[model samples]
Target: MTDAESPANGSGVGAVRSHLESTISGTLESRNAGAFVHAGSRHDPTVRYCRVALGRRWPRERGREVVAVAFDGDEWLTASSDDASGHPAETLAVRLAERSGSNTILTPAAVPHDAALYLERAGLDLASTDVVARARATKTTAERDRIADAQAAASAGIRRAASLLADAAIDDGRLAADGDPITPNRLRTTIDEAIVSAGAFPAGTTVVNPDPEHAPSTLDGEGTANDGDTSEVPLRPGEPIVLETAPRGPDGYHAGLVRTLVVDSDGGRERRAHVGATQSFRSAAAMLTADAESVTSVEADLEAEVRAFGFGEGDDVRTRAFGVGLEPCERPFEGGDRIDPGSVVRLESAVHVDDGSWLRIADLLVSSEDGERAAYLEAPSRSLEPSALLE
Candidate 1:
């Protein structure tokens, strides 16, 4: 499961939680005397204010003692007031700040503008950009395991989709199973069901781009089959199909996978591009070692590898490498920030074909302790030979 999906046990917070505390403590120290006020729901994606404040999942009924213990004597405040007669959450937070002898309250940058204004008017100095995100970016060992589990589950979903494609029968220009032509919607439903059965949440929209050469403008709404009903199109042999899925495990961590495939067609050009993408992925993975200096350098190395394979970074080709954690695409790598050991990243390479078709491959890689090489979390073969899928 992803770290975001993983349930926090009753046990106190560990390394990641401690790092969050240290980050907030450091921020508080720099700003003089103040407490960090995290105002948000328990499920807020960006801040997860309650989790950070409590050092674990929020205990709904436990009163101030739990709060005091989690804070460890540090003056911290939370806007969890449900009492309508007393004060609104924001107003209560301001009052708590006043009583705690802290004149300032550090809030996350994701706070709504209205809430920020309220804090400002409460006679409390408000600082934006809390350390929660920074702490989240650098995951602990346990968090990495959760992410790995999520990635594994996502990979399982991809395998299930590939298996369906492999077993599908091509009749004329359409793909079918058991005498029924398969539609994109059917395929997506099957994929999502498989993902859920495999212990991961169904990714809302699994992109299924059939006939990549003449890809659809968008994947919104129910898919189309050949007849233009809800299922508007049918899978045609020889056409390159791009399948991308980002599934979240029960723990709330997300993992992504993208692969290009073809049925009975001659896959010479597509195979070449697939090989190029695989090679580029390897080259990028090599740069994720402990000694890697910066994300910019790694991206440059990846781009150079793609260029070496005769692919340009223009409209035809696309590449991405970023860290993955609570979110499918996490920070540092997303922001092109510095490289740190133990950061898990996903690297992708795609090359467009002359016919508007494209082949792409993506995999997860974790930085090594020495920062010289990365460990491949998912290293499936990238061969585009039809036999590979058929068998």
Candidate 2:
């Protein structure tokens, strides 16, 4: 996290202030701007917000207020409860608005519905939108560092899983490690452990799909193979195992990694699909630039390449390019939003083979300033060579 006392020049807060100044003529109000504390515990977003807003962590010195307002005609005002009146945040905000003679305040879209109603009842006009999301989409140098740390942890987890797959003993068409059979549950646990040990938070559960037909179609779905009894099905040669994970570091930034590997061989179709997916990912990533064309145009080019490589329409092949930061899927690189320099995004491609299996790969890339090419954040080799996993 960046120092709170330091100026947030060109940071998300600055971006948000610029947006509000241009859009609204009144003051802006925010509440619960930090994380909710329960039993002496708080989440990372709250901590990060506090670091950004106050240059400090939570448990904010009780009477010291964290709520801030950027008044249109005046400078920014940051206040805490002045007295022991025990006033709620909304009440204080209402009082501030009335005192300042401002009728409406712009809030972020994440504000709860009840909060909105309360603000409305207090005679404060509220304009809510994804302002915070927009601010977060473009990361600061500190935020990028945290994300890179998280991505390193995610890569460690992936390498651990690959090592397990490569070293497992294949006996009677079953995979065994350390004299015990390797199940999806066990593998997921191992990956989580590796991630946590590598300085990341504990990943609740990872998607380990040894069966292509049973893999979740979307990236967000839960992983359940062999009817949720993944141990019942052992590893088989020539079968694709999809291992996908999104792990967050202690600082609360997430990095996503997805790789599909085969125990022995992937047959000809899987190899072709892998090649196509790789091509699609590289093509799309190459087009990501600060002043590049529209996302739709880049996507069209990627789809065309995939189709030309034999994974055409109705083959269930999909490609997505989006930002990755505090959240795995931050603001999408879509809707005509020009790619901003320093924006970290992921290019993902998943292709379903004729044998009812899936081949997928994803990589992280960051757009560069003028005259510079986009850089790869996580440069793990995408080679499908089985020997690479063993090494």
TM-score of 1: 0.82
TM-scores, one per candidate: 0.82, 0.77
Best by TM-score: 1
lDDT of 2 by residue, 1-391 (tens): 2211222334445443454343333223343121121010123242244345333333423433434333333343333334224333455455545565556565555554654565567766766545455556666666677778878887777788778877878878777778877666666777788887887764553677634355322222244332334344555666777777778765557787778877778368888888777787666666764365555665576667777777657777777677787667777566576557767777777777745477778777777766577777764556565457445
Q: What is the lDDT of candidate 1?
A: 0.62
RMSD of each: 4.8, 6.3
lDDT of 1 by residue, 1-391 (tens): 3323335554424665666678778877776646665444445554352353345554444233211111212644444434334324456555655575677667677665655666667776767764667767666666677777777766666666677777789888788777877666666776677777778886574667633334431254334332233334676777777777778766566777777767776856676676667777777766665365466777667667767766655646677778776677766664357667767777777777756567777777777674356777753356564346324
Off by over 4 Å in 2: 1-53, 59-88, 98-101, 210-228, 333-336, 354-356, 389-391
Q: How many backbone clashes does candidate 1 have?
A: 21
- Scored by lDDT, model 2 comes in at 0.60
Q: Could you tell me which residue pairs clash in candidate 2?
A: 4-55, 35-46, 65-80
